[model samples]
Target: RDRGGRGDRGDRGGHRGGGHAALLPPGRTPGGTQHAAKEGRASLRVSGVHGPEAGLNGIYLPTDVESHDFSCWHQNDSFYKVWLCRGPRAFWIFQPASQRGTAQGFMISKERHLERPQDATTWRLWRDGGWKVFSTIHVREASPKDVDSDAARGRAPPKKPP
Candidate 1:
């Protein structure tokens, strides 16, 4: 069953939201705790201890920043549960759960979700062609050096980095 309180139908129903409720718990992350809004669009701030797989984790934002899809967004302008599967190399398995009937085969599936990237820094999020990367930024207090550098370059410092 999905977080929506229904059995998985495999793509024969309407688009659903709140898919990440099962994967992510409220106010929990690797470095600290932060809460995602329950009813509005928000960013999923991913953080983890930098290790041999340092590049494996980072911030994942929806293709539409304003999109209510707080989970993974598909190129077709829908949200999906992007499963990162381990193989010789890591890959994605996104079989969107339907709400009405069984339709599990990928051939009949309409949504083309995020495909694997050549490297950890990018992902193919669009069909026509556009690759996006997980944000390497973690929210923290900026030092005076950062402000000075921005001013020297004639660029205004961001009120907040997203």
Candidate 2:
């Protein structure tokens, strides 16, 4: 289970407040959320259990395993913040602990105002006795003018032009 900030009160576009408080890096908060006064300080606790169907412990559908609560904080320095839970466990499908590796049933913060394309990030859960980061895909925002130009051009630009 998980608990953190509340969802945005208005139609301000997917912004939330008073929920899972992740640690901030130095002078930055992720997605403009309030940062903690100290570094590496988690404003909220994240914990959950993974079932056998999660493919953990070599079991196709093992019983639910309880997970320890992890301290999270907000950091604006990076486009996103990541937290990994060591050991074979499952996190809450909703709220703060949004799965992002190879597992199913994960949720992202409503306050995360960035618009992401499909497959931009893949959530995975491994059972090698600890939480491991399988992969991460970062999506950068395109400027309004760039988007307009791309639309006019009728095609996306190459990853890296020669």
Candidate 3:
């Protein structure tokens, strides 16, 4: 399931970019243009179940987009779902424990923003089992009118139950 995430990243073959692009080392992600990856991160999802034993795991996008790194999705809430994209960039997904090194301890059900700067965070340490995670959001692209229209037609994004 580990496919095309920006972090804990490994090379894959599918899409092919032009030869010798500067964004990555030679022969990394092929056909993935600088424009695609530069535009933003690709959409991806987590692999396997969540647990302390789980450590960090796979992060990959759909096969259709394995070679690209740009996405457009709608989001209006204070928080939205996201995933780490595939190489030099990633969000660093982890077990979400209360204490950084204690993935074996309590784990948060879901993610909030990173509370500390990248330097201060222990969850990023591979030994702690942290892997990069990311997503490119376009909340700005979803207008209030579009939102109203979707909500009126019942095509809106899902709302959390109050």
Which parts of model 2 have CA positions greater than 4 angstroms off? 1-26, 33-43, 51-106, 109-162
- Candidate 1: worst 10 consecutive residues by lDDT? 99-108
Q: For this target, which candidate reaches the highest TM-score against the unseen true structure?
A: 3
Model 2: worst 10 consecutive residues (lDDT sum): 55-64
Q: How do these models rank on TM-score, best leading?
A: 3, 1, 2
Question: Number of clashing pairs, model 2?
Answer: 32
In model 3, the runs with Cα more than 4 Å from the true position are: 1-139
Q: Distance from true position, residue 15, model 2, in Å?
A: 19
The TM-score obtained by model 1 is 0.20
Question: What does the lDDT come to for candidate 3?
Answer: 0.25
- The digit string of per-residue lDDT tens for model 3 on 1-162 reads 322221223422111112222344422333333222224333222223334323223222212222224221212222222222222222223212111111111112122233211211233222233332222111112234545654565433423211
Q: Write the per-residue lDDT of candidate 2 for residues 103-128, one digit (tens) a residue.
A: 22223322222222221243333234
User: What lDDT score belongs to each candidate, Candidate 1 first?
Assistant: 0.25, 0.25, 0.25
